[model samples]
Target chain A: MTEPTAVIHDIGYRHYDGVRLGRGRATLALGVQSLRGVFGFGRTTRAKIMPLLLMAIMLMPTVVSIGVMALAKQFIMPYPGYAVFMQAVIAVFLAAQSPYLVAPDLRFRVLPLYLSRPLTVTDYVVAKLAALAVALFGLLAVPITIQFVGELLVDLPGPPHTADYLGALGGAVLYAVLLSSVGIALASFTPRRGLGVAVVIAFYMFTAAVSTLFYAVLSSTGRDDVAPWALILNPFFLVDTVQSALFGTAPINDEGYPPGIAACLILLAVIALAVTGVLLRYRKAAS
Target chain B: MTASATPCFATEGLTKRFPRVTALDDLTVAAGTGVTGLVGANGAGKSTLIKILLGLLPPTSGRASVLGLDTATQGLEIRRAVGYMPEHDCLPPDISATEFVVHMAQMSGLPRTAARERAADTLRHVGLDEERYRPMGGYSTGMRQRVKLAQALVHDPRLVFLDEPTNGLDPQGRDDMLALIRRVGTEFGIDVLVTSHLLGELERVCDHVIVIDGGRLLRSSAIREFTRAEQTIAVEVEEGQRRLAERLAALGETVAAQGRLLTVQVSADDPGRTHDAVRDAVCDLGLSLLRLEQRRGRIEDVFKEPVA
Candidate 1:
């Protein structure tokens, strides 16, 4: 038998031959990617519509508040109380948009792809939570910044205005952390975005309704003293309670706000629970 | 192999038991470099073993190591070094392949600029052209598999675990994917642990083959050794094939005539004598020796061998 001739062909396959940045850099990159994912960047146009619309809805109230303040020479929306004024809109935004951060990854079984990378489960959880927190922070900061700039432009009393602006900035950061943790924590459980959105909204709406009902009953029964206990159950009321205590914003509800220490403790507990939930959820094989 | 040269992976009495059933049972094996085909039927613990090696699942007892890194403790390091293409369809539908692969490259610790450039190169290498820009939701099964392969290789891993990559592909698609997998091993020099339930598909590309049955290793050896010549020789004669077979049988040789050819069992005491006897019988009978060939063992023959 004749021997067969051998030939070689170039496939243009090259090795990376680059420095690997390791797990820390990997976690940071995942965080940045998830952050962009939250805003629907690099996703389909249909994916972008929801985040963009919710963002616009989130900004409209601030734009209107800023416009009113500029024209009327009065603070239409208090800086610290802005999240409270648009609590439902902000809640809706968190409920609808936060799932975009995690649910799709879970639904698509892409966790294997990630866990197979240089990242650990804890790193994944941190990256996702950080991304959502940053997105939520950016989401809320825009409105707060608009209001702060409006206050500065209109020359609303310098000392108090600057102090309130700083306080509002701090309050926005707190709100972003708490709300984003809760939203993404819930979203991570389900693979379906619709289910994620529904579960989140149901959670927010149910707790708010229950808190309102319980507080109304207590006030009607002449036990107004205990009404503050009911407001602590709802995240919206919890945020309002904390914001009022933190920035010294006037209470928006008829039931008196919980004391700063009590509100802070409860908010911390909620944040802890949500963050723990995120960690525990990822502790299992996500795929 | 030298003592300094570690196998791609080695397992020692590895066992994994779920709540209801045991998936892997005391599997002890070592896979050397080059393409190693992991052949097992469905539900034979192939995926379970892969998960344990990936450090995604903890084995119930014993230990495993990938690239000399202990799977129990150095899971992240193992993952960092190895790439995996899952058996299922796991691509996100809303995102384009370019964006998704870039994100994965970045997630693998590449900087943004490096990730994008690597993703582009990797996609091109996987045969995804401008169509990489389109969302994966509309991609064909073949395209989706290419996308999956692109993501796995984009990070330039030292080894890759391809679990049933040709699962949903057509015949032509399977051939193309197998060719690509062969290129990955031969051209790129990346060690591969590819799995398939089909017995013969991997015979062409793999240097070694590992066969697992019911979660236990049935055999692990070089493909060439596994398919080594059996103690049998196929003989043909130009004319009087039956007469030649009769003459060979009369010479105290076990012979079975199969139409134009005869299968002679080589004497266990002296295998070379069987070939000599056949030539002598053919020469004496005035019959021309048409063809003489030794039969090689096939993968299917392993199943027929009695379990030890």
Candidate 2:
């Protein structure tokens, strides 16, 4: 047979098995591809440089917080506690940067390049979320750990005993995961990266502001009892509630640890639903 | 051309619908070996069909297959064997061609070492030169298109779908691209499904041609069938053109003068006789023969027919 004929025969035999790579293998390959894509490997240098720049920017708050504590410790007291400061920084970073990470691949039709490979819609979504979460953790972890060590060195009273470190780590991880999911969910609604960024920032900042405004109104009106319930309106507050509990803050008069846990559970459920919606939207957009 | 034992690509009643448009509607065509041109105007469903075959787009109705694998269920399998050069410019501007093509090869399941080797070979094949190491953002349109083609072939796919590969090229660039495409299909032994709006361009290279209009199949046949041998021969003479025409008609040939040339009809099976008769008649008439050649129908002629 001629070379072309031989190729045809080879293709035919290859097709007999139908799919050469099993589903599990294909999924794993796709996941790796997505990680490579998100990290900008084998793509444009901007893809490589942009993520680096974004991470650096995300870590900016850590540097700023550390500087403020070291240089002007007398004025910046309570230090807002490292957990609160780190949480705020992460919220801002996700609001500003997460959208850019996920939106462009779909908006610019770059998703076809990924989808054309063995990658599935779910794999792409998971990879993106994982990438953002990892970046967020890197940004938050270094500064928080530094601040924790610094506070110890200065012999300052910390928020919790050493016994609570594990719980605090768990709380931070939970918050990071939820934040990543929420950022992706919001980004999925629009293809425009700038718009996605703006929307996410607004979603995070606006809900937090509204929840605060509601609490202030309730407190001024002598209804401090109802402030904890009002906190449920904000996902960030749910995160804060968990942090506050980990730090052994005063429990709400009406409800105890179970309510805060329930609220966190509810927030997680929302994150799951939002993630599902995003994935479905991505799949539809791909098709 | 006789029917091959198996078709390179075949589709049946493929349909796809979007909210704003019916992108592909009951389209069906079968293509054999060599370069097959899928010609259609913009928004004519050419891209849609290519995407469906690649399993990028799910058909709302009907069925399709590539290399005998079902597109609906085994798109990944088909993609592994069928390369695709998309029409859009979506390259990451910062990465080098080496990195991009290697990643694509790896994506198609090649090992790291093999992917790198294939990437280098394919990039050289596309004539990227030393600029392959530079970022793609600074490259010219022609270079970008070549890079896209290189990545598509980096996996050594058996068949490839090149959508509007020459869309942004100048005439010379377009010619070069067409030549390269011909080499890929013929010299490299890869079956090519290339789409173009330029009918004349495909006429020179494609072994088969499939015309589509309004998301529907109009015609699909070998290029030879589209440009079949005509019974008429066009004759041009330096002098005695009128006398030559008169002599040809006197010899039982039906002839007509088209400007300085004469068109003579002959029996379909007697093409050699028609040529001899024309030469004899011109010589006897003492006329200087300028040109004598059979005229075949162009692919553009088929475009003039009503869509079926």
Candidate with best lDDT: 1
Best by TM-score: 1
lDDT tens digits, residue span B1-308, model 2: 35467677888998899889998899878888889999888999999898899988889999988888899899878877888888988686656778778766666666667777778778777788899988676889899999889878877888999999998999888988999999898777889999988666786789888988788888887776665433468899998888887787787787888898788876566667778889898777787778887654444557777653
Interface RMSD of each: 1.4, 5.6
Question: What does the lDDT read for residue A81 in candidate 1?
Answer: 68
RMSD of 2: 7.6
Judged by lDDT against the true structure, how good is candidate 1?
A: 0.84
**Model 2: chain B TM-score vs. truth?**
0.77
Candidate 2: tens digits of C-alpha lDDT, residues A1-287 = 55554332311111111224443444455455555555566455765776566556655655665566566662242222344544455666677667766776666566777676666778678767877676565555655565556655544334423434444555567667788888888988887878987898888778878877987787789876786667666665576566656555432223422366677677778888988887888878887
Runs of candidate 2 exceeding 4 Å displacement: A1-81, A145-162, A243-258, B1-6, B17-25, B111-113, B229-300, B304-308
**Can you give the DockQ of every candidate in the order shown?**
0.55, 0.20
Misplaced by over 4 Å in model 1 are A1-11, A157-160, B1-4, B229-300, B306-308
Docking class of 1: medium
Candidate 1 local lDDT, A1-287, one digit each (tens): 97869875654888997877889998988888778777888666787887788889888877887777778767777666677777888888888887877887888999889888888788888888888878877877887787778777777644436666677677778888898899988998998999999999998899989988998899889987888899778886787778778777666676578788898998999899999998888877553
